[model samples]
Target: MALQDRPNEKPEASPADLVSSLAEASLALARAASEGEAYAALDMAAHRLAALSSGRVSICELGMSPNGRALILWQSSRGGLSIGEDSLFAEWYTRASRMGGEMTPARGHIWYGLLSADTLNDETGIRVAIFLKFDEMKEELAAHAYGLADIAAAVALRIRKQKAAALERRRFDGMYETTRAWLELGADIVWEASPEGILRCRRILNRRGDISRLVDGMDLRSLRIGGGGQSLLDFLEQQGSVRHMRAHLPEDAQGRMSTGETLYVSATARRSPDEDAPYIGTFTAIGRDAPSDGTRETATMLLQMRGARIREEQHRREAEAMLQGLRLLLSQDSSREKMSRLVGLVGECIGSSDACVAEKGLDGKVRILVPQQKSPGPGAAAALDFIAAGAPRGVVGVYDIDAAEGRNIADAFGLEGCQVAALALPLRGDAAFLVCVTRRAEGFAPADLDFADRFALLLRQALLLREEQSHLAQTAKMAALGQMSASIAHELRQPLNTISLAVQNLEFLLESLDFDREAAAKKTKRVLAQVERASDVIDRMRRFGRKSVGEHASLVLRNVIENVEAIMHHVLLRAGVRLEVEISPDVTAYADQLQLEQVIGNLLQNAVDAISGIGAKHERAEGLIKITASPSPDEKGMTVLRVEDSGPGFRPEIAERVLEPFFTTKSAEHGTGLGLAICDAIIRESGGRIEIGNHAAGGFVQIVLPRQPA
Candidate 1:
């Protein structure tokens, strides 16, 4: 209380004057009307204390939050003390009352002390902090910092009062003016309710409407807003409160102009601890004219989704119809009637009328195809001939009757007043087919033309198929003839060679002039046997040539193998390749005997050739060709025949493709590539599978056939 005791004090300041100034500042803070005035009063008191201490000091008034944390609300400093920059000073201010004082060495040694202990625990209370350089200030100023608690309490009280007043002001402004403004903007109502569906208040905000007649303090269910299973009040109870609840209001007994329009509402509620504190909430409503951004976005997305679904359904229908039409067209037999029906179906599917087909006659003229016998008129015939003669390759040419080149056809067909589109397609076997559609409002689209081209392709493929079948039949006849010729030559050459050998023996005996009678008889007998063998070979050849196609029966597979060996044994022996046969007598197959014989003969010949070639290349003494027929492994009612040779196998890359038609590893002269191809066709047609692969030692060809049921 005396200036002489403070070493850091100004020499002129008296203790009594300082005390008087402090009292004035405290009185002003207690009577302060606003936060700014209260802060000014506290700052004045802090400055008075600083003057008495004769040392630079900074004062910070901190507020306790509801959570009991302190925040700086006001700061006053003297002589550039820079207290706020120090984080240590901030920590001291927050817990200053409890900490009492602290010392910081950062930047410089500074002393920090709490000013108010009485208001430290109050949420709205003020706590003050004092900062000074410890080395520059005397220790007596520490006492002044500790004695400022009463002044801080007065400042805290004034601030709490001002905060209450400001809160009340905001509430008052929001309640009346905010609701009224929304009403002017066409809001239907603003309301308040309890948690138990009891309506506490309702204000019709719209001025020109009679909605004010809506009774307040009525149950919310009286409005009868149909939503989900739960009432609006129950929904609010579960959700705390929901915003933008869309609901429709029904007609009520009170004659208050109910428009029954959908209203968008927002609401909020709070629960309290006290028994008297019931749930309270307010809700504001707007009419249908205005929608939130979320609602608009959702509607737009739904519209786009609906449009995409429609397009997807349309494409699916079109694809299904196209598939059905193709199936119908393919089911018809390959004849002129099939083509006619196909054109009619196409005309129906493509939305055309008066469709027709034209074919090129053998007389070098294009004739229109119809159900009845009718040729094109002279003019149209001439036009068709001109177009067919000059038709470009690979293009389905389009013609419109109105064009100069199409006028002759237009006049001949009497299409002057009618619109006509014509497509001319070139077919196989020097044929031209014409299709026409009449009475169309527009020209054919690219989709229509593409469809027409594909339909024409279908006909072309059918024609090509017929031609291929005929050619294959002819080729098969020639192949049979060639095989018969080879067998005959192979069989007769051995006997002929034997006969010549017998003649040479006879000549040697005669030249030596010591011929034995037994030796001549044996030579003469061998020659007659050779001649009989030649005749038998000729007779077999004749029988094979006359064999009927499709003549099939259950035959012993073992017997077929024996016959093939008999026919090929001489050739195989001549090639120096030993033939080995392993077949069970019970193995039998249902197949054409002649075809089966040819297949077996071809396989035997191929094996012989392969072994002979390998023998020629490297005189392999192990030239073994094995033919085996037995029941197929793991397959019921089936028989497997394999022809394996001790010759070089096919290259690894060519193994799988060796069974393909015309795929052969032999030289061109030794094989026409059709031998195995024809054999494969025959075996497959007889209900069998042919597999060819190489074993470790040599190549093997296996054929599995369904066995004949006894």
Candidate 2:
């Protein structure tokens, strides 16, 4: 029957009955196997409390959500009644509990009491809530409600602890299974030995039946067929570890014992300060082999091969890293910047803070290319001395400052104290480059020296290439200058002749005794203008002949075209070729100005030569050369300058070879064949190219360049 239907008079609970009911609840909870059974036992306890008080009592287990924002009614004594954190009863109970009052309720004659599970603490966020319904609020009934709630809290905490333990046990079981399977698959035999090198436990993982009994309880050291080397126990005692140590079993009296079989053992053990410790290791059986020296040699060779493979892999990775850094260094636009970054990259690769590149000149003086300073550091002097002594060419030398024999070498490199080391690699000739790297630690290994040698060789090749290019460019420039000398002489003679005439007129006017001052002044101004004009021609030629430093900047197309036209005008006039130039003043390109001038002049000269040849062949033919510049139609962000001539286009058979170095159509005295090749190189260096082709009008040579940004 429901408690509300009971007599109005509250029945007082006897102490013996309450104690018996508490004992029954505790007994039920102790025997509970799962959370459901535990909850059921708590429910019975709540009913017993209600029966004792003759009042309706409800027990609810409350837990915080993972986010701790709301209460969860995990379990309850009453059935078919839902209570949420938002409910009026729940809100009132929560507030009353915090306020430390038991009188607050949302319904008639209802009182709330909170029970603590101190063991659960905040980690579990679990507590018990009891609601009691009576005709009036009584202290005795409130006490009973709290007692039931306490029993429920204790049961819940016990269940949670049991669940946690079970989960941990399952996790460990999975780990043990995984580890056992891994060992069985990967190891031939796994073993453990006592401090005295006696076998404690050994597991053979072969597919064949167990043979472990044959060697059970035997001293592991007794299994080896000893020669003259240290025993396995000695290795373990000294190094605390052993790897790939060869051992063999004694030959059986039968024929099988005569055949040689070996075991490869590897082990690691713990060591204490005052005593030896037991060890665990692995052993793999090797096939039959010849006894003694042959077996040992084969094992040694195998180990060496393995070590070589590992070292080779390491070297490949390091080489790749160094190559990547080198590509970045080469991308730099300035020579000085590239040199500075080169030294930095070398230092990083060698794990040193001091590195430099020095050039040994023919005059026997060494100069530092990087750092851009005159003074040398500690190792710099020693490196220079080695270079001066003609250090073995193409070989990297390493010196340990701490060694007696190496002390002199160390002093040369400026290494003063012990432990520091220096590495020097000289280029192939007496007058060549030297690369030095110094570490303030132990000497460099053979592999490091090898890498440094290779890097130095690469630097040498690059320098040699740059020098050859410079020489070829200078040669081509001088050739062009020589070809233009005749035209240039005639060009200067015209102004000089005009100045001479003007001077003679002034002198005659002054000596005639009826000299006109205005006329004389006019003659004098004419002479001055002629002199200035002659000076301008010489200045343009001088600038064009100057060497290029390979710096790029925006260049006005019209200005460069005009400068080239001035140099080539007399040549064209003397050859009877009409030159037409069509270019806008605003059109610009990104390139070295002097190099661009050289390229344009070379093209104009070639056109003049081609048209002159055609004229010589056809006596009545008109020679015409046209130069035009504009933004390229086929490529974005590019400018095209075309030099077209009204001459017979290149011969089909020789067209492809026209730009090749040392490949020329003209006789030896007329052309050196480097003019077009040099022009192509200069254009390519500026991130551009030259295209040779024929249009309907005649042959055209186009200079394509990166256009200047607006």
Give per-candidate clash totals: 0, 5
Ten-residue stretch with the least lDDT total in model 1: 1-10
How far is 118's C-alpha from truth in model 2 (Å)?
Answer: 70
What tens-digit string does per-residue lDDT give for candidate 2 at 1-710? Answer: 11222223333568677658756976896688788998887777666666665556666777554333336566454322234455445445434433223334543333434555433332344677765564566676666555656666776777887886687567655755544543433345667777787765456554312335434465656665336556667767677877667655444412232234455667777675443437777665555653223133334434665576567656755665466445533431233434555556555566555555555554555555555433344564445665445446666555555555356644443434433333343344435444444554565656766666666655554455445665678778878888899988998999999999999898899998887999999999999999999999999888878876555678999998888888888888998989888999988899888889888888888887777773224232788888889998746788999999877777666666777898887777778788898887777656566777787766899887877521
Q: Model 2 clash pairs?
A: 252-257, 378-414, 379-413, 382-412, 382-413
Report lDDT (CA) for all predictions. Answer: 0.58, 0.63
> Model 1, 1-710: lDDT tens per residue?
10011233343658788777767876786687777776777677666766666555556665544443455666764323445433444334423332223322221234545466542423333556565544454444555555554556555665676676677567655644654444333345556665465665445433423443453565655543336635566666667766555543444633343443344555555666442424443333334565422232334434665576566544544454455344433431223333555566556545566655655545656555432234466676576666566555445555666776656655654444234445555554546555555556575655666665655655555445434533453465456457446556877898999999999999887788676889989999999999999997776656444433434468898888777666666667677788888888888887778778777777777777766663224345587988888886645777888999887766666654555567766676566667776666566545565667777767788887767621
Model 2 regions more than 4 Å off: 1-307, 315-453, 614-620, 708-710
lDDT of 1: 0.58
Q: How far is candidate 1 from the true structure (C-alpha RMSD, Å)?
A: 39.6
Q: What TM-score, computed on C-alpha atoms, does each candidate reach?
A: 0.33, 0.45
What lDDT does candidate 2 reach at residue 644?
95
